[model samples]
Target: MKRFFLLVLCIFATSCTGGGSCAGKKEVAALPDTFIWNLYSDPKSIDPGLVQENSGSDVGVQLFEGLTEYHPETNEPVPALATSSDVSSDGLLYTFHLRQDAKWSNGDPVTAHDFEYSWKRALDPKTGSYYASYFYIIKGGQEFNEGKNTDGNSVMVKALDDVTLQVTLKHPAHYFPQMIAYPAYRPVHRKTVETFGDKWTHPEHIVSNGPYKLVSWEVQKEMVAEKNPYYWDAQNVRINRIRFLLIEERETALKKHLEGSAHYTDDIPTLKIPTLKSNPHYHDAIQLATYYYSINTKKKPFDDVRVRQALAMSIEREKITNVLQQGYPTRNLVPPGIPGYTTAKGLSFNPEKARQLLSEAGFQDPKTLKVTLSYNTNENHKLIAEMVQNMWKENLGVEAELYNQEWKSHLKNVEEGNYEVGRFTWIGDYVDPLTFLEITTTASTQNYSKWSNPVYDDLVLVQSGKERDPKKRFELLQQAEEMMLEQAPLIPLYHYGRPLLLDPRVKGFYGNLQDMHPVKFAWFEEEK
Candidate 1:
């Protein structure tokens, strides 16, 4: 312990300065290696298979590694645990050559069998992982998830050897390599999970193959992770410790940032974006996420296409954009800037047309029907819901009720179709349009709206499989988007862009659409 302290002091004292701690470099460096980050709220779960939102994903990414990962800067798929891989001539089979030196935090060898066990565990109906639908591209994956096939042999995933993983896809999927980078595909140590049971996700028993390992978790207070010595690429890891503080209030997090208590934060208030933009450390990145209202298509009056379109057209999205002041003012499902694909344009703002459509949908006086807008408790979400309420009242003389639920409850209610219109946002798991479009498929478990469009389903699922040309496949997806918009089951609002106040002390920070921060390549630098 004395030697470790002396080593940290030596690096900090000599590394000398830039970013934010220039004047206090010696004092800052004399302490233990630590990076303080902010978490807006409690993560739903640390288990990779159960994580569905960005809050959980951020922590999950640090504690686990999949077959591959998004390149820090480019957001492109790159090898991580896998040393090399090969694809069959038909593009249906992928054989991954795992790195033999990889080991979990508990010193267990990370092998193909670990992946086999973890993948099958996620697909197990008992696990109830919503993202398991992501693996449907693999042969028999859907059947396994639906419990139609209990035998493991029916699944396409196989461990041919200790270091080789073979996968057979239902059809050619060019983006399959990138898709594997998502947390649902991350491997868990079979022995660790079996021994610890539900406690396996606790910091004490958690075993991971990522660059860092969980050291302590204090629930709604904070969690800490230390560098994993057993990690295959541990030599390249620079940061020694990362501390995540669970802070719900944006103002509280910002106050901590100003006091030098934190080095990174994504919880800053949207209203502060304009003021913070002048600061050098203030950062903004275009995220592949959309904040939209999930209209329950199974119920009235939202069941009618015209009624849904009317409500969508009535909302003045530009007013919301002015407050956000980051992402694009879009009524699109897919965010812009995706390579080789155009975003889906749903409906435009026109109060006159909205009223006309509302009347046409059999509601002469829209105010006669009261609808509920359910959302999680957040300052921004509450304010947006208020804005929407006013918009509906002024444009169509409609009355809408607002209900605030906790994160987990909100998700359950949305998925169960318990509300008329619910607030929802989807951050892409991968850089493909399928990440955005697939969720709206009739078959997707993440389809909160309970919307089912048979023709729309075929375009994304059936046709994309048969179309060999990538361009043609994307076009088919585009047609699907157009068809879904024409029906208007989903009311598009605005795209999401993250505004971060990052401390210069934390060097080598890379921001992308996914907003994934891999701390392995990050290090502390003296602030200039």
Candidate 2:
């Protein structure tokens, strides 16, 4: 494992020399003027209604505004784009009062109609929006999404006036306020999206109502966003400009940070952890992200619960954590530090118990069991997958093959059910443990495992429908977590610690356990 970590660092250092074109530049202490961070892929869209993942959402947070926002430290819901909000006693109807000062990047007032159009567009079957299900609580939203109902008569979302909007829900949800804080639920200017079509995010077509506006975007190179002078809070935006540079190689990012081309970077090689911890400028901590392997329950081998349990038991989670992960080990899908996570009954690593279960289930010979474990090319994912492959071959007497795919294609495979066992991860989109643990529910689109448990589904459904009592609702969610652990449809790997290298001169740029990056308060001073 130590050798593997060293190998990664060595590859990174090697790539900085002859492989990449920037190899010739001299290194320095900090970036010159511009603030840059590293991203593996360019943002898919600046339009909030269309963003489905963190890559898009992270950028969307900078480019769009939602009716509500989470208080940076407490995760409490507060008004952002909306001035005030109210919920009916039944909890099915929500009304939001828009802030009069809200305006689009192009200087048009952002009204209740913008929210109405955005919600309708997302719920319309023609949009093919994956995040549309988030609005299912809204009246007729599910029917509209399924084409059972038309847009005109749907009562899920509507504008009562220029600044007041109403949202009717099929059922009440306690987390609905938190849900609104996510970019996928943010409001968008319909005319802008319609006018730009597919090129809506292609720089020239970009419009933002947040603190920053898209000023320039160079594919696979750099994306530059300048402060929106027209934003309601423009005077309070501490950073004048932000540049997101797409640097896939950790070594290249490190080199750029060292050379003063980037102020902060995401991937800090594990070997550098000790030194990074020692430095005052470097802030390294376990981010809320959890890494796990999803077994395609729809496929062979994995369809057998014994095989899944055997595979889960063969690998040593502690070994992987101590050896490969710079962060902490995760016992289940629900990450620690979240509101509802309990470690008392988490997944136990017992090889003997696992083997007994496997043998009882009739898996004995290595020849009888054949499976494929797939992962993306991230050094961490590959390293862990290799460790699991070796563990399975040694302990279970099973023949296992490893498959590596590019990140995008790998995500496609997992989403399309193209593999028997595949790697997957989730960082909380909000503070709730339900966001991570509930992704496996039969109704969840992100449920790549295709795992279905009627009891588990009922627990979640009932809670989302009637459990208004926060304490009782959480108890029901705990029951759902227990059921998932019992099924073992997914292997709970380690929770990730996000390690970032930052310049000493930069301030107010940091992230919390939820991976929330708020650059609004960040500012730069000349390096001494």
Candidate 3:
């Protein structure tokens, strides 16, 4: 992170020589072979099958091996446990040739059977995995997860031999390989799991197949991982250890980074973005993620589209972006310029129109309607909520009470529809626009909004299946996005940018659109 920061400072300095903001930066020191990173919240779960959040995923990737992985720099799907693949002409059948050399941290052979067990375990109704929907593209996957079939054999995932796996898909998805890199699809050590039961992922019992193994975990303080000596390709791994510290406040994270104890952080205090903007150590990537608030369409007031629209438009999104000084201004559910698809625009800010909509929704003066805006206990989230709270009051005369809860509780409340509206963000697991559009589908477990429309549902869930041409499929997807925007189940605020503190010596760590970088590829360059 510090290394990346210094590079940025030099680049920015060259462009801003007249102002010379970065003229006097000192040389950065090479970090020891240990990378220290920060997480906004402690991971909710580290279990490969159960972990749903990104913090868990960051650790999951280091401690588990998947059939494929995203290239560190290009973000392209490449073989990992699998050495090669062959697809049937229809693109529905994928035959993976697994690497014979792969082994778990326990020295047990990593076989095609491991992946078969893991994928089926994910699809099993008994697992209650929220992310099981990610594999719904595989034939019979949805039926298996939904309990329509008790037979795991009915699902099209099969291990043909010790080192060969086959997957039959319901449709030909161009992005399925990329999606496979997600931690939920990674193999688990079945014997360890059977022995430990639900405690299989404990630091002591977990037998991972990735480049790192869990060394220690101090709970809310930090979790440490060290290089696996037995890793199949251990020689290529540079950093020997990684520490993921859980610190909610970006200010504290920045202090840790500036003091040289921390190598990277997910976010810095927004106020610091300007000062560090020209600093070489600061980094921000426009991630494939959207920052929005979920409106519980099952709840009153929000059950009305006008009410949702009015609330969405009343808040000025630009003001929020200006304050953060990160990300592009967007009224889009799918962030604009996502490669192939046309960006769908949502309701724009017009205070008068917001007032008219509120009136139409039977709140002649919205102050009579009291709503609670719930968010996680992060300072940035609090400040943004307060700004929107004032906007609701000043623009539409609504009384919005601000509520903050810890990350885990906040997500649970949103899932249970315990709040009328709550803060949420969706980072695309893959580059596909479908990653964003599919989440709000009628049947998706991740659809916290509880907003369902037959037309929108069919565009995503049904029509999407029949469209074989890439352009036609995207067209169907755009139709779905348009319907979703019209209904306004959530407020489209702005796209995300990972405003991070990076050590200058940290090398080979790449941030893709999804903003995921495997720690195995990271190294500290020799400082001159």
lDDT of each: 0.80, 0.72, 0.82
Model 1 lDDT tens row, 1-528: 011001110111122122443122334322337888897777777787787887777788888998886666555667788766788888888888888899999888999998888888888888988788998898998899888999877888999999999999998887887788887789888888889987888887899999999899887788888899998888878788888888888898887776667778886787877877776567777788888888999998778889888888899898887876766777788878778987666788899999999889888988786889999978889989999999999998999999999888998888777889999888887777778888889879988777888888888888888889988888998888878776777777888788887776666666667888777767776555
Put down candidate 3 lDDT per residue, 1-528, tens digits, no spaces: 011001110111111112211233433223477888887577888888999888998899899879887666666667788777788877788888888889899899999999999999988988888798898999999999988999999999999999999999998777887889888889998899889989888888889999999988887788989998878889978888888887777788777777666777767787888898776666667788899988999989789999998888888999999987887777888987667789876788988998898899888867788899999988789989999999998898899999889988898888888999899889888887888888898878889999888888888877887688878888888888887988889887889888776666667675557877788766776444
Model 2 segments more than 4 A misplaced: 1-33, 340-346, 526-528
Tens-digit per-residue lDDT, 1-528, candidate 2:
011001010101010111111222664323334577776566655566667666677778888878876554444556677776778877777888787888999999999998888888877777767677677667887778877877546746888988988888777776777788778788777787898887877778877788888888888787888888888878867777778887767777777776667767777766656655655446655576788888999887678887788778777787887875376776677776755546325557777777777777777555587888899777777788888888877777777799998777887888889998899887776666667766787867778999999888878765546777767777787778877876888888888887776666665555457666656656665544
Poorly placed runs, candidate 1 (over 4 Å): 1-32
Q: Looking at candidate 3, what is the lDDT of residue 73? A: 62
Clashing pairs in 1: 17-526, 18-526, 18-527, 18-528, 19-527, 19-528, 20-527
Best-to-worst lDDT order: 3, 1, 2
Name the weakest run of 10 consecutive residues (lDDT summed) in model 1: 1-10
What is the TM-score of each predicted model, taking all chains together? 0.94, 0.89, 0.93
Output the lDDT of residue 311, model 3.
88
